[model samples]
Target: MSLYDEVGGAAAIDAAVDGFYGKVLADPLLSPLFASMDMTAMRRKQKMFFAAVFKGEANGADGYMRSAHKRLVDDGLIGDAHFDAVALHLQATLEDLSVPGHLVRQIMTAAAGLRNAVLNR
Candidate 1:
């Protein structure tokens, strides 16, 4: 089965997204970065991002990217440190859920690509 099938599609992705954001928001260093947005919107965008990722569809992710995180660096909300924290939290989340290492690596790699684009440091 493809990684997409292993991920259990949208329902699993939604659950994972919720769990991921819960971890992010609970971390003091990260929550403040999200203080300006409505949690509902964040949740929706996260679901969309995860859906695209696990479904092997990324073309539309740019819309969510633009809306959810385009200002991450510009607004001084995220930098290298924040990216590391996010990576750590996400890996822990996947580990906690017993997701396969391959799937986890895919997520980390994809996130790293975004991190490089934003941090550039």
Candidate 2:
């Protein structure tokens, strides 16, 4: 099974995204970056992006992630600290959902692999 399927597919991913972003938006460090944005759309996009990533779908194309996050990098609003916080939120979300430990690690690894691109490093 794909990582997506192993993690319970779209519904699971969607739920995680919701929970993860709730934490993110509540975080002082991350909240400012999203203060002016439409969270509903952001959540939708994140769901699509992560679903694509775990499913190995073309929609998760490298350029999309890079481009999508480019403005944040350019504005100096995103860096290792922000990325780490996001990662933590994701980890916590998965854990809270009771995902298998090994699978959570795998998912986190995949997320970490994208840090450079996401941070525009």
Candidate 3:
């Protein structure tokens, strides 16, 4: 089963995204990066991104991730540490939602694989 379905599909992703942003916005290290972002748009994109990834239909995700963060990477606002922080927040969000540990690990592994793309390396 896809991770999206395994974790309860759209509803789960929605909750996870909301929970993730709640933590991220509260995090001093991560919050500043989103100071002027259009959160509604950001959240919408996140939902679409996660849905595509979890559904195994992320055809252009790598390129998308690279382009999406290119500016931040160029400005030095994004780096390994920031990526790790985001990953940690994602993991915590999944756990907080009571997702099974095995699935969480699977999801995290997939996320980790995107590190290079996200970091624009």
Q: What is the TM-score of each candidate against the true structure?
A: 0.82, 0.93, 0.97
lDDT of every model, 2 decimals: 0.76, 0.89, 0.94
* Lowest summed lDDT window (length 10), candidate 1: 60-69
Instruction: Please give, for residues 4-116, the per-residue lDDT of candidate 2 as tens digits.
Output: 99999989988999999999999999999999999999999989888888888855466776898899899887889999999999999999999999999998998888888
Give the C-alpha miss distance for residue 105 in model 1, angstroms.
1.5
The digit string of per-residue lDDT tens for model 1 on 6-28 reads 87777767677778888999999
Residue pairs in collision within model 2: none
| Highest TM-score model number | 3
lDDT-sorted candidate list, best first: 3, 2, 1
What is the full ranking by TM-score, best candidate first?
3, 2, 1
Which residue pairs collide in model 1, if any? Answer: none
Model 1 segments more than 4 A misplaced: 60-68
User: What does the lDDT come to for candidate 3?
Assistant: 0.94
> Would you list the clashing residue pairs of candidate 3?
none
Q: Which scores greater on TM-score, model 2 or model 3?
A: 3
Model 1 lDDT, full chain set = 0.76
